[model samples]
Target: MPFVIAVLLAADAVSLMAAGDRAFAARDFRAALFAYQDLTREDPGSASVWVRLGETYARMGHDLEAGESFSRALRLNGKNASAKEGLAASRERLAILSPPPKPVVDEAGARERYTAAVRMINERNYRDALNALDEALRKRPGYAVALVARGSARMGLLDYDAAAADYSAARGSDPSLASPLFGLAEAYRALGQPAKAAQLYRAYAESPATDVQPALKEYALRNAQSLGSQ
Candidate 1:
């Protein structure tokens, strides 16, 4: 009777482990997690079980739990690659979840505010231009046009570092935005990154255009001159 009971328990553990493997293979992370959780409970000494559980958690975006499970797996089987990979991924996910210190705001309303700021900058209203750009960014997060305008405004104000940051953000939001790329090139040049500026300028020159050939030619010539100076 005792032997039969032991065999039944073993069968149950094997069934759970097989189910977990199937779920993992299917990329059904939630189902895998449940199955692995059951297996881990049934066979606490199984390091592979813990590794699978950790992998499932990581796939499901439960970084903290994944980390803990991976750690436990490593404790039992130090050479486990899956556990090590899960631990690394979990740490990376946790790092991403960590909030940065600075506040970033850029949105749709930023377009109007940035346009106004550009007008103010043209009129030599430096301080007002800065304030308007700031307000625009505060209202619209990740507004590429506003970022480019703010960078341009900052450049006029001689705030080179801030201008570079704004230009970088603008370029990041839309890599194909020609104006922002131009602004980045100019910003980099101003900041003494002449090589970087020339590279960006070259990119701008090589980019395809939908506009008139005359404008494209002029833009290409300007970038060529800038690159030559570098």
Candidate 2:
């Protein structure tokens, strides 16, 4: 029975490793991270698994986690060249004082598209608004305001999943931007994720008055209260 259990565990590790590799090759960092994390839990002593986790974290720009994972792999197997390389790379990234500069973009054209999207949204033409926002994002990737507007357009079109994704991207691009919180909360609510919705609503409500309008804050608080009851 012990031998059989060992074989099953080995099979599970093999399956997870394959899944992680496939996800990593496809640039699906989130899925790769999940599989690698599960591998860490199941086989903590596997230096290979730790190295793979480190690679996934590095690809996702999580330098701190990558550094830690690489260190763990090196500790488990001091001769692991991959772990050493990853550790060195992560350390270099960590040592950088400021982030690299962004690529030059046509800001004027992007702003024009964003303005068109806002106008379309005001007219309730969500489809057109989405198209304009897409053009704006294509011109200027990581445009936080355009992302928020796109999220709103997606919400209007009942595409809650896409809306949530856009809102999440906007939040990542500009953590201090307050609009994504309310938009993301509404998207979560529409997607039936009441807990996440409530959490975001509470966050929106608690934002400084200078950041969030009084009426929006009041509305967010009311929604938070309503969702918390569920």
Candidate 3:
């Protein structure tokens, strides 16, 4: 009975290998991949089975998976020439798939977009201001002034959530900047977060930035006091 069971298992393995080979030869790589995957699960110790799975993955343009499968085969049998070749081929293909990093935008280009956004904001054209700010931010991801401006534009458009996000980001990028704190306070107030709004308003009023005019500080303090009363 034991001998019979062993023979049956061996025959099943052979059948799966043959099925995979036939599918591979017919250019049905998906079917080949499934068959080989099953064979690998059944006989994980077999380097040849892993090699077949790796080959199917390569044919299907799954270079990363192919490389992993080939690496597994190499671990099982360090003498696996097919696994070595497949790993190298996968690496070559992967390198081709990955493009070079984008070149950094020049400072002047980012400033140009930012200047346009400021002009549009002054004209009360919040929609066009947002478009310009998007380009500016893409060119310079951590532009604190631009983020503050974008927050104001979002406010004008009644996009309170986005305004809050931009204000928060601006504050994070330049903690000492009173403009972002004021913007963030207003955004929080609009978002119904009164406690946060009050805290930020007080902070903006107390900020030591010389550009924060006396009238603006007085207004911020008034808002903070009003929210505190609530």
Best candidate, lDDT: 2
- lDDT per residue as tens, model 1, 115-173: 88989988988789889988897887677777888888888888888898998898788
Question: Which 10-residue span in candidate 3 carries the lowest summed lDDT?
Answer: 100-109
Instruction: Summarize candidate 3's per-residue lDDT along 116-174 as a digit string, tens digits.
Output: 99999999999999999998988888888899999999999999999989988988998
Clash pairs of candidate 1? 106-140, 106-141, 106-142, 107-140, 107-141
lDDT (10s digit) by residue, model 2, range 1-230: 59999999989999999999999999999999999999998899999999999999999999999999999999999999999999999999888946888777879989999999999999999999999999999889999999999999999999999999999999999899888999999999999999999999999989763568788999999999999999
Better by TM-score, candidate 2 or 1: 2
Q: Name the lDDT of candidate 2.
A: 0.94
lDDT for 101 (candidate 3): 79
Query: What would the TM-scores of all predictions be?
Result: 0.49, 0.55, 0.58
Judge candidate 3 against the unseen true structure and give its global Cα lDDT, from 0 to 1.
Answer: 0.92
Answer with 1 or 3, whichever has the higher lDDT.
3
**Model 3 stretches with alpha carbons more than 4 Å out:** 1-103
Worst lDDT 10-window in candidate 2: 207-216
Candidate 3 collision pairs: none
Clashes of each: 5, 0, 0
**Measured by TM-score, how close is model 1 to the native structure?**
0.49
Scored by CA lDDT, what does every candidate get?
A: 0.82, 0.94, 0.92
Off by over 4 Å in 1: 1-109, 209-226
